[model samples]
Target: MTDTTPADELRTAAQTLLDLADDTAEDMATNDYWRSAVVEPKHWFHNGIDNAVGGPAGKLAGLMSPRFARMLAIYFRDEAGRGQDFDTRAVTLARVMNGGQP
Candidate 1:
């Protein structure tokens, strides 16, 4: 059995979500309906995140992981294009969570 800390679990969960977002973005990029319906209305993703997460920062916090939450907060607060491509944002967050420069 391998022992993993809570932080480790959080990081793994975050990475999984980020990868999903990246895949969704990749698919959306090629779909005209998504482009017009989602991309065009900049707030669509933001609203969805906010709603799904239960607040602007709720999603990360709701993860029940402090370290991951902090990383996400910092990313959302300081990163550019918060309302743009989700794949890019997810990748950026994943990099930071992994201790890489985003």
Candidate 2:
């Protein structure tokens, strides 16, 4: 039996996009493309409005170089958030997903 909780599954899902950047040279979400190349479409946010915005942003983020992705991941994992500018949610999320790994 699996000991994973719902939160664990969500973190795992979030890690999916982040992990696509790993071991990659240029692209991040390679699996999102290949896995759904001919079947279901790949999407981060559904709904016409949200998809309109997040769709492009997600695609752009996914195109980030592996180095950039790694650095961002590292930043989110280690650096604490300043003022109300960057919230700690992402930081905490990254820390959770990375499990304190750098």
Candidate 3:
């Protein structure tokens, strides 16, 4: 039996999705996947960062010192890794919220 509440699980899963997006952006930057004749990696990376952490999360992440933010980005990127699909997670989360098993 799990002691965790539904709200707790939902919050954890949302954070995981955000972290996954952040990590994917970092990977794109690190692996030079954003480099191409038509695209600049720096612009692509920052755009991703903005999209990933936008709104309230963006405000909080922006409040961190430059070094701390960079470190945290790297940490999240490494810890979360890649290949997870946020779209699928969204669907699952929706199901769970509706009292259905994902």
Candidate whose lDDT is highest: 3
Q: TM-score per candidate, in order?
A: 0.39, 0.29, 0.37
Question: Which consecutive 10 residues in model 1 have the weakest lDDT in total?
Answer: 77-86
lDDT for residue 80 in candidate 3, whole number 0-100: 34
Candidate 1, 3-94: lDDT as tens digits:
74334433564655556566655654565444334344544444444455786486654343333444564454433333343345455555
Is candidate 1 or 3 superior in TM-score?
A: 1
**Residue 54 of model 3, lDDT score:** 94
Error of 2 at 75 (Å): 0.9
lDDT over C-alpha atoms for residue 47 of model 2: 25
Q: How many residue pairs clash in each candidate?
A: 0, 0, 0
> Model 1: clashing residue pairs?
none
Report the lDDT tens digits of candidate 3 across residue range 33-66.
4455554544554444455679877656534433
lDDT of each residue in 1-94, candidate 2, tens digit only: 9875334433453455367566443232443423333333333212222433567775565445445556665555333323334445664565
Where model 1 places Cα greater than 4 Å from the true spot, the runs are 37-39, 44-102
Q: Is candidate 1 or candidate 2 better by lDDT?
A: 1
The weakest ten consecutive residues by lDDT in model 3 span 78-87
